[model samples]
Target: MREAAPPKQLAFDLPLDPRYGREDFLVGPANEAAYGLIEAWPRWPDTVCLITGPSGSGKSHLASIWATRSHAWTVPASEVTADSVTHLVSNGALVIEDIDRPEGREEAALFHLLNLARENGSPVLITAAAPVEALGLVTADLRSRLRLAPGATILPPDDALMRAVLVKLFVDRQLVVDLSVVEAIALRIDRSLARARAVVAELDRDALRRGRRITRPLAMSVLADLGVPDDETDEDDAPA
Candidate 1:
């Protein structure tokens, strides 16, 4: 007996977007101000700023772009400490990520880092998934400073952002998907950068295994297979 042939796959070999620079960051009403503010750089209203958004929003991306523009070092929330702060702020700026995640005594260190960075004239960009006040920081001064900043939140992606995100995800994966299929998928999915990214990843795998093009019907099938229902139906797909 002859051995069976393996499944045919459409190779989608490409790196994630490397141009996460200011120019590469897409802008729409939802994230326009946040984009502009971060781009403003070295001219922030305050030494420290809070950028809040839902998990899939582009808070981290904006932070990354600012990090590049400001030539800042990046530190995870868990690693923030007085000792680490001095080293991280050597560049006169730093990107402190995941300030929303609760960790023991970590926020207090952030409070000190904020003051120290301000004293050193180094600005800090703080990214959170929730409102700045809602992170449950135990330090009162930290809370006060954050409240004073009263930062901007990256709202969920709008239609234009959603479509652009979908196309970018597909292109990064080196998969050329039809616009109709992208719109079909976008309408059915939650409007978030993360959701757009996740849907593309899932569809990429499904297409490779099934040898199917990323099309409207295939998108419908994949959405079902992922147990993510097409919550809103598109009139274009409906019968006359």
Candidate 2:
């Protein structure tokens, strides 16, 4: 007789696409400034405004909200080019995202787009991981133009914001987790929406793999597996 095969480990790895609707965004102190800037719209301090934050800090969500309200299309940094500036400006308003990722010839193209957008009275919203000064753009004119645009920065999440983010992430994944579980994990992890997302994903995967429901013990085990230490100090030490 053939030997029995080992059990296969199960996984739930479906992609989770977050909803970018205005109502879907969670507002907290960390991102209120950025949210307000997006809400201010054409009344913005300048025709161009920049929003900066760490990865997964809701920069794209804020940009999406603005794009919808302004009836503008979004162009990634890599896609901005001299050849596309005319068509980009034709959109009446624009959002250029992830400017930190410089691609071939992107510096000159972005400079051209900015100039054309200004001349045509089209408002532009730009998002990056860092401010204009830190992007290290070789184009002098582009640097000058970017600096002119007023900017908002989204700080990391606080305890309340992190808990809220965890709840939202669970809802986005259609997981009905208990409040205690949310509270338990929120205290242990760093103050990052990205980290919250990772934790939730890991817990979901672990629960599914074990063919068990998500519970406090499972959450703790998953947290340990992910190397997230339990420290309440994160709440007290949140950024101001």
**Candidate maximizing TM-score:** 2
Clash count list over all predictions:
0, 0
Clashing residue pairs, backbone N/CA/C < 3 A, model 2: none
For residues 63-133, could you state the per-residue lDDT of candidate 1 as single tens digits? Answer: 88888888888877889876776777778888888888887347667877888888998888888888866
- Candidate 2 stretches with Cα past 4 Å from truth are 1-9, 231-240
Pairs that collide in candidate 1 are none
Q: What is the TM-score of each candidate against the true structure?
A: 0.89, 0.90
Among all windows of 10 consecutive residues in model 1, the one with the lowest summed lDDT is 10-19
lDDT of each: 0.81, 0.87
